[model samples]
Target chain A: MNATREELSEKGKKRRDFITLTATAMGGVLAGSIAWPLLQSMNPAADTLAESITEVNLAPILSGAALTVIWQGKPVFIRHRTQQEIAEAEDAPMSALPDPQTDKSRVLKPQWLIVTGICTHLGCVPLGQKKTEPRGEYGGWFCPCHGSHYDTSGRIRKGPAPTNMIVPPYTFVKEDLIRIGESS
Target chain B: MAKQSQNPYRHPFVRWIEHRLPIISFFEHTLKHYQVPKNLSFLWTGGFIAGFMLVVMIITGILLAMHYIPHPDHAFDSVERIMREVNFGWLIRYLHANGASLFFLVVYMHMFRSIYYGSYKSPRELLWIIGMIIFLIMMATAFLGYVLPWGQMSYWGATVITNLFTAIPWVGDSILEWLLGAPYVGAPALNKFFALHYLLPFLMFLMVFIHVWALHTNGSNNPTGVEPKTAEDTIPFHPYYTVKDLLSITAFMVIFAFFIFFAPNFFGEPENYIPADPMVTPAHIVPEWYFLPFYAILRAIPDKLGGFVAMISSILVLFALPWIDRSKVRSLTFRPISRALFWVFILDVIILGWAGAKPAEGNYIIIGQFATAYYFIHFLILVPLVSRFEKPSGLPESLSAYYKNSCHD
Candidate 1:
């Protein structure tokens, strides 16, 4: 509508449209290319990358118990979930969860649920690895820092956290051993 | 607004670039050709000076940050090493430290200039509020920066101020602990302060962008406090005001250079030279001179919560300036009683600062209470009441009329 009638020939209009479309596409590519380096810089620095791969011995963890291991300077929780904790987690309606994750889908084995202990909000480590510490109302992990309660499946059921605890790329090398960091 | 064909300075390459970007034209339109009132005084030059000082602070801050450590154990030692050994480190450090004080000096003068002229009146209310917010951010940024040195004053100041949060009822203690990141001001507090100090200048930069944008939208308020009615009353910002601003900056730098070369430690407290001693408390603890007036107001009240509220209220009171002084006349030049009262208020503030520096005991406490009372009275009662009753002098018909009258004199 801003264009004058003199410049509104069908061929001229088509040409103008093509130019605008081409320019927009080029701008998108330019913006992405410019943003690439900044995004790359945040992708875990060299020191963090060096410590990214961690091997955990699964033999030490007992049923209904969790062990925390350091991977990329973050606490990763590996729980040997008992049948009761698994049932309780399985009974949770996924639709009702703040961050919905089925207990079965979160674990590789029926008895083991491995997740990063870091809270989705503000990155404080949740506390449920020790037997003495409060496992919160959901009986999994309670973040004393801000009171985010994680269920047995590490799905955020309550408090300020917006997502389930992240499942780091991990695979069992043997029945008693596992390696974290690289996806199979 | 500039077209390629109309742009005299546009080369073929520039024309081609302008077709795509037009950045040069944007600067030309915004900065070079922007019209400002012709009768603006040296006080009006404060914005340019403040902008120049911000750039100086950023450059010096970046250089200092390169050598400074954030960790509590190494922070003091690293600063000392920078002062002693690093190349031109002493110069950069002194510039940043003294630059902060000078920044406050210019800002306070700018604020007072705004007050004397009714720059905050009417449509410029948002602009004035933004300016006050910038002042607050500057205070926060300076406080965080002070803590990075891990000096005696830095430690105690952080402790005392952060502990002020505890005056709140239910969530106070938790908030204080969260702010400190521990039971006391230690490593966690130091690290967080360093990060925030680095971040806040960028936030200030964003606020300044908005401030300038808002200023352009409304145009500047001049000494006459009259809007420019004709093209004859205004001039392009570039050659006229730019040159004047440059001259003012040159004069400022001469004083700045004197401080940098000679009496660098004059503005700084001697206690800051000592490393932060948590075990030992200094007999007298005072904030930087700029904060002294508010600090005086804090000590004036007997109750902790009352003191905290009073201190905060002093700064928050500034946001109401646009509304509080209900006068039809703009500049104090026309209002004789208000003009006299403005000076009294300034003297009251200076006295408060002096009292703040001294211990909160005996005569000093009495002085602080009186000054504090006068400060509120000046704003709450005098500004509004005086505006209602005071008879202002006759106004000039226009800026040109004032200029013509001045020429005759």
Candidate 2:
């Protein structure tokens, strides 16, 4: 009877050990399964956030008119110039501006009234030049924020602004539609 | 041990020097004296994984700086030149960029692992706090480094973030100017940011040392959440933990390599391709995704100072976690209520992240407010309260209880 009792006790001990081992293993597996997916899920979302592009519309403004749109929270001005403005822009002397360029080089094939809008100075938005101002041999938007003036070509003619207004990469969607965010 | 006596050059001075610096002896002592819980599972590897990523960031950051130019005029063109002409420049840049996301990924897991296992409790409180410090420094370093590329996102991201200080009541403008070294986020800001970004990692490295020291001081918290009480319950640190840590690191590298090689551009902003134009702002100026949750918190409050306070408090609250949790039990396995609350916390963080990505409009603000409130509640109220009222399953009486209990059947 003593031997039989000892044998029963031994068997019970082994069974309990097995159960504990199994529970521990199960716990590890559960932890791992949860953690692996959590770690993996973090990667794809970050990738998607980084590589995504945005689109901007440029159809509302008429020729010789400028409008502002916020991209990444900074204001970007898109100006549309009429055909006459484009012709007049060419007569502006390259010597008068910080960066001198002909219309063919600055704007895309046909749509013109120089597309650049950034102020060359400290980057504040420059107020638009009114139509009544003397062409000053070059007719374009004048930035009133500082005294910086530009001819129709969007070249920096006079003032503290260092560079001519930037010409952003844009493409026409249709006769009137223009996509400003990405190049085709 | 006396075998060195055969060599006459092994004089008293040499012996004293050897005794003082005894690296071999130190290793032996570490191997012998250091005891780890025998039941530690894979979750323990997250800490090491995070440490490894920190090293990777520092290494890649230093290399990237070799070709990087900090001046605003040259910064954009220089980065372009690196991508186009510099040897393996693209590889270095992508690695550094992707490395930031991976570092944060590992760190969050490391932190969560600490939370779930109750690693932050009692004697290990200092370790957890040190880890939090590392997290904060990492955030600052990554933020500054993001501006180095001088892309559209870089410029506007800097602009918006620097403007945050301007929310301060009286000296806000001066503070902003001080940070920029100029009236605006221009050349001076970029230059100074580069200098500081270059310096912060070394500081991170020192803090990591402290983190490890504190970790070792308390020993590692294990999966069972039960502290080891005797030799029978512990194993030597070398063969047991070294092998496990190495295996897990190897596994982590495989995933890291997969991103570095295949999906390099996956985490970068497309607007960054355009050079920064101050006058021409991109419509949506979002920071890097890692910062989204905090950014969400920043925008959550309608008031400027209130938003800033809320944003900072979100991080500051983490430092108080160790004390706030009142549970006698360390591990969540036995604490049913705490486990449920833990999941709620996770969901709250995710909701905050989602709210961060959405524009602060209409329902999003309400959602953010709710999530932000839940975030604080989880720490300040739920942790302590749940810990106090919840009855934990009784613990094993000693380290050898498992063995004794098994023997008794």
Candidate 3:
């Protein structure tokens, strides 16, 4: 111990500090590299990420009727909008909406509106897909869990939901075929 | 430390080994010869019980883990299987489950006892901080362990807690996904949590070792809070504390046994017996009873981010306590005003726990809001002000003078 102390004293403070710093930097990088893999391993695994697409044929849905499909383990509502509903959605004042989105901007065509059925407030499946189900004041969907109301455009119009209904990434795979979870 | 004289009786074998390793002496010093404040009351038994509880939890936990399946589908049924199929498995599971509650109960008493005696003061601050770190690890371990059963309360509790991170700005959602390992709680989250839950207790054991090392440096604070100044003020560890602690442990086991045998599910939510369903959230979800105070604090704030911050700050503030209350007197027995405030603080925590059990609406919310406000007030404002201003009764010249060798060896 005395000999080592003498040697360190001879090396002087500056050299010892440099040696200490270098060793610390090396140790930190080594630790970080070891930790990175352990951390990255926790991200979504390949099978889970492979939750890709759900194809829904619009042929069966008449105007004013809606179809509910399950995509990515969540319900997605595809409503064939009536002309009057479309017109009403288009005319609703933007300032009145809790979470605002233009009706035209929300849909690809004037007669079709598609939005994920889960409530934005908390993840409850909203009521509105069936004719007998109660849609709230705006005539889109009503969340029984928290009483959130959506308009014809599937925009959050009232109650506790913080934003408009989510529009999952989707595209028209065919004129009558809409594939959810794939965007192109 | 006082040196031990060499034994003249030479067992050549034992002496040779002792010269090389000294492991026997190390154990002797810590377990047999260490001096403690002579006047320590039964309250000091909390530490011994806490250490004993750690052993119970780890042994029971490891056995339960043997039959516990980590996957969501098998998790709930496997717990039931353990209860039904494995001989004496129900006893082991109940011991482990109820063991967690008792462990927390003991630890909370351990902490509050320290707080009441001002044991977090100087020279003991690092020991207290290490104890706090042990506590944080305990909370994390308990939470991860709770989710392993994968029932309604476990699943929803995971969802609620993991989502709280999303209240952070910019990187919140990313952090939440990283924590859960998916868009939501599932197999990945369960696997990671199980891995961590098993690992933390060993880490906590190591921390407790350090905490004890820190404690031995300054020795224990007693009811009088006066430092031992002479040999007369202290007692050896072997018989006095060991027998007293053994007695206390035996007495405590009776109550713990009552819970394990008679009220096995007393600390658990009935909803947890039902398997987890992702689609339907239970109308009211609650955490384990031990978590109630902090849980109430979380919901007391209206804003998501604010509530998360407040709840975290409640714990983090304790780490700063040694500096916060800088009073010269170390125990509440000397500070009458502080003692009154201490009891009130205890009541506020119980009220918060009560509020936490109720749904977050109506009068419950209002009650929680008041209790939450008072908790912070008592800690940050009242403690400091009282510490600064309270007239402590004149302290004894020495612990020997205080006890008058009433507890001689």
lDDT of 1 at B191: 84
**In lDDT terms, how accurate is model 1?**
0.83
Q: Write the per-residue lDDT of candidate 2 for residues B1-409, one digit (tens) a residue.
A: 4745532335677666555566555666666678888878788888888878878888888887888899989999998888789999888877888989988888888899899989999989989888899899999999899998899989978876776776677897667766776655777678889999999999999998899888878788886687898887789988888889899999988888888899987878899989988765555566788898898787677655677889999999999888899887888877889999999899989999988877656688789889998988888888889999998874566545744665742
Candidate 3 lDDT over residue span B131-232, tens digit each: 999999999999999999899888878877887777677897788778878877788888889999999999999999999999988899998898888888
Give the higher-lDDT candidate: 1 or 2: 1
State each model's CA lDDT, in order: 0.83, 0.75, 0.86
Per-residue alpha-carbon lDDT of candidate 3 for residues A4-95, written as tens digits (9 for 90 to 100): 98787877987989999999999999999999998888777777767669999999999989988877655688999998899889999989
Judging by TM-score, tell me the better candidate of 2 and 3.
3
Look at candidate 2 and tell me the lDDT of residue B387: 94
Q: After superposition, how far is residue B304 of candidate 3 from its true place, in Å?
A: 1.1
Chain B, per-candidate TM-score: 0.97, 0.92, 0.96
| Docking band of candidate 3 | acceptable
What is the DockQ ranking, best to worst?
3, 2, 1
Residue B367 lDDT (model 3): 99
In order of TM-score, best first, we have 3, 1, 2
Off by over 4 Å in 3: A1-25, A56-70, A73-165, A172-178, B1-13, B403-409
TM-score of each: 0.69, 0.68, 0.86
Models ranked on lDDT: 3, 1, 2
Give the CAPRI class of candidate 2.
Answer: incorrect
Q: Looking at candidate 1, what is the lDDT of residue A110?
A: 70
DockQ of each: 0.02, 0.04, 0.27
